[model samples]
Target: TMDIRKNKIREAVQTFENLEHRMEPVATVRGVDFVNDSKATNVNSTWYALESMTKPTILVLGGVDKGNDYSLIKDLVEEKVKAIVCMGTDNSKIHEAFDGVVKLVDTANAQDAVQASFSLASPGDVVLLSPACASFDLFKNYEDRGKQFKDAVKSL
Candidate 1:
């Protein structure tokens, strides 16, 4: 009985998918991968997402600012991100943080953000939605934000 249970546990672990809104892969459209990490509503979470990136990234960032300090991810953004699509009500802070470091575009919604990020991407590049701020400003929640991102990617 113990052996059977252990094997089942191992199988479950092997088959387990990442949680929704947390490093979820939405789709790959025209060779560009789209990832939804909308659960990353803090600098540290976004940092981990950026740290794991292996390809050039067009990052979709922003939402409801919770007094987030962009400096924490500045170096990582400079290193891994090729462009930034700001999705939020107020994006002046995002622009201020990433303007000279990378190309920045402002967007007010998920579809626009995804489209802008896609436009900035090339083959083998990734469009990552790892907003380091709360989603209340534009979305009901992180899951809602992630769902919108997925839907937009599917539409492409």
Candidate 2:
């Protein structure tokens, strides 16, 4: 089993999003829904982010697929994602899995990915960069990936 305390905290955070669904929609705030889930090399983290969203979402997904099974987040993508912008050189699998389920775009670098995501997202929508794979594909590590995402978001 994993760390109980950490699991509890995650459960608590997810529960809050679940609860937020009940809140009535008021005014929509226009901002990029930037997410830095570059540590999700196993696919589960991407699934968590997708499941947690209550707003229109643009998913920025890419990186080295480590035996990834994209089907795991398929339904979540169809339900919450407004579009899918990839940030990797090789995106054959990501495209094959979600080509029709959502609009698909690709980027060779972080800047393009962020810009494309911003374009796909609108007010009250989220531009989520939850790469469900390894960061070594384009970045030195997960921290680098996260920092790039934050910088791009701040620039927007």
Q: List model 1 lDDT by residue over 76-106, tens digit each.
A: 9989999999999998888888878999999
TM-score of 2: 0.80
Off by over 4 Å in 1: 1-17
Quote each prediction's TM-score: 0.91, 0.80
Clashes of each: 0, 1
Q: Ten residues in a row with the worst lDDT in model 2? A: 20-29
The stretch of ten residues in a row with the least summed lDDT in candidate 1 is 12-21
Point to the candidate with the largest lDDT. 1
